[model samples]
Target: MHIVVCIKQVPDSAQIRVHPVTNTIMRQGVPAIVNPYDLFALEEALRLKDKFGGKVTMLCMGPPQAEDALKKCISFGADDAVLVTDRSFAGADTLATSYALAAAIRQIGKEQKVDIVFTGKQTIDGDTAQVGPGIAKRLGLQLLTYVSRIADLDLEKDTITVERRAEGGVQVLQTAVPCLITMLEGTNEMRFAPLENMIHAARYPVRKWNKEAAGIEDVTKIGLKGSPTVVSKVFGPTPRAEKALMQSVEDATPRDVSLNVIQKIFTQHPTLERDILAKASV
Candidate 1:
């Protein structure tokens, strides 16, 4: 049960402040934390590792500072950590990101066969649950997203069974080993870091790989150069033109307020009264 958990370092939600002029997130001076959702994924992977008695590896793709995220996972009981960082990977969309991560996983797979890859449901910044699918597609690994519960894990048969969340209800799906799983948030709480794990994580020498080091020969497919969609601009949602106005009670009572509001609506637009009465009969 060599489980690999893919975690991400993200700006803390409390310190997330977008630059008004540049239309970009102000990451500078913002404290970073393990992506909230990824915590659940890591916890699940750790649980599996504990049950099956195998190693758990944590992988991340971000700036060098992202090593902190991996270290945090180590404190939670991951065996090893890998950091995939390259300037060429900047501005990468979900597709490009998946490509890079999958390549890194392949490199690590040569040493020890990775039985499973775990990820969160989605990222807070992107919120697009596409990277996991993209990674699975590239690696030819079975993808199971939005897993709410793990019904069973069979080491002998090399198979895993889980309860996945679908549009309407849960879908029980089974897949072979070497699959990718995206964990649903709130499924399991992260365990507290014990002293042993904390000591190891602090001194853990996380392996670092650049684009070429990860065996990404296709330079075109490595960064924003490979991304199909371009974000010309990102801004907050447009504000509404006007807010709803409340009607005060002239007679100082709930009944009076209701009556006054109705009268005001009718007086402002008499035709609205007829339409309301016609629909009220239904």
Candidate 2:
């Protein structure tokens, strides 16, 4: 069971800044951490690898600094880490991201068949859950998003059963292997890396791949050129209308406020008073 977990390095939301010229996220200076949701997927992959007695590999596509995120996964018990970084991969949206990830997985498959691929439900910056499904579609893998728990695993049958989160409740679905599963948040706690694991991560030689190295032959298919959607503008949050006015009464009795509110309402709409009086019993 060789499981591949796809993780991402994201800017700490509290430290995020937008570039004035490009209107893009200013990633420099701000510290980056593994996408919070990816931790759930990584932990689940590690747990499954522990039970099944196989290897787990962590993969990510981001700037060169993203190697830190891959190393962190090594600290959490992943056997190998692959970092795909290149200027060609910059400015990638979900569609382009999925294309690159699926390509990397294909290259990995050439070495050994991957049993499963794992991804987080969404990223804080993107907040779009489309990438996982896009990857699944490209790879022809079964797409399982918002999975809450692994109900059962049958190695012999090459099948996995999981409880998926839905609008009202959970849905139990059984799917074959070589599938992609996106773990839901708060499903499982991430394991703390021990002293030995931490040391291993510090010493691990992370594999880096450039555009050609990651097997990207088409220049237009790996970055913004490959993305279908374009964000025209990014704006600050809009303020809501309506304001609250509190009376300065010392007691602030409900009766007084209610009467005052009624007066104000009737003053705005005089017919409201007639309608309310007609409807009232007394």
Candidate 3:
């Protein structure tokens, strides 16, 4: 079984800055980290590999510096790492990203047969939750999203069973191999890397691929040109002027404090007091 995990290197949200003039995210001087959600997917894939005794490949689409993210996955037990970085892939939206990633997966299939593909529920930067289904559609694979647990895998039968999160309850789903799964966060914890694996990951020669190498043939379907959505501006929510009022009852008795709060509520909203009295009569 060959499992492919797609990951992204994103700016640390805590350290991210917005360009004052352009109203864009300023990635310069911001520390980069693997999308936290993607780590859950990687950990689940690694667990599968541990049980099935097959190879797990980590794939990413980002700048050259994203190689570090791939190396981190290697330390967590990924068998191979591939970085697909190119100027042509800059400013890609979810649609274009899926196109490029599906193309790269095709290229990887030529080298090894891929039985499953895993991705995060969503990225912190782009929380659209569209890429996984888009990649599945493009690749003609089964699509499963918000998976909480992988219950079973039948290698001989080429089928997988998983528990998917739904509106009210969990959905137990069975699907064929070569499916795409977007793992939900908090499903599994990432494992610690061994000392030897950490050393190996630091020295690992990660494969780097450009647009051509990643098997993207059409120039019109990648990068800024391929993206349909345009961001006019990015800004944080405005802070409200009036702060919330706090009630202090440190020295007062509980009953007195409760009565004080009730009186204040009635004073603030006379209609609320009348409505409460009317309801109490029932």
Candidate lDDT scores, in order, read 0.89, 0.90, 0.94
lDDT of 3 by residue, 1-282 (tens): 899999999888988878776667777898889999999999999999889888999999999999999999999899999999999999999989999999999999999999999999999988889999999999999999999999999999999999999999999999999899999999999999999999999999999999999999898999899899887776766657998656667878888889988999999999999999999999
lDDT score, candidate 1 = 0.89
For model 1, what is the alpha-carbon lDDT of residue 248? 61
Please report, as a residue range, the 10-residue window in candidate 1 with the lowest summed lDDT.
243-252
Clashes of 3: 0
Tens-digit per-residue lDDT, 1-282, candidate 2? 999999999888889887766667777799899999999999999999889888898889998879999999999899999999999888898889999998988888887799999999999878999889999999999989999999998989999999999999999999999899999999999999999999999999999988877777677887989988898887755456865656756767878988998889899999988888889956
Judging by lDDT against the true structure, name the best candidate: 3
What is the clash count of model 1? 0
Is candidate 2 or 3 superior in lDDT? 3
Which residue runs of candidate 1 sit more than 4 Å off their true CA positions? 19-24, 242-282
Which window of ten consecutive residues has the lowest lDDT sum in model 2? 236-245
Of 1 and 2, the candidate ranking higher by TM-score: 1
lDDT of 1 at 265: 85
Comparison by lDDT, 1 against 2, better one: 2
lDDT, residue 206, candidate 3? 97
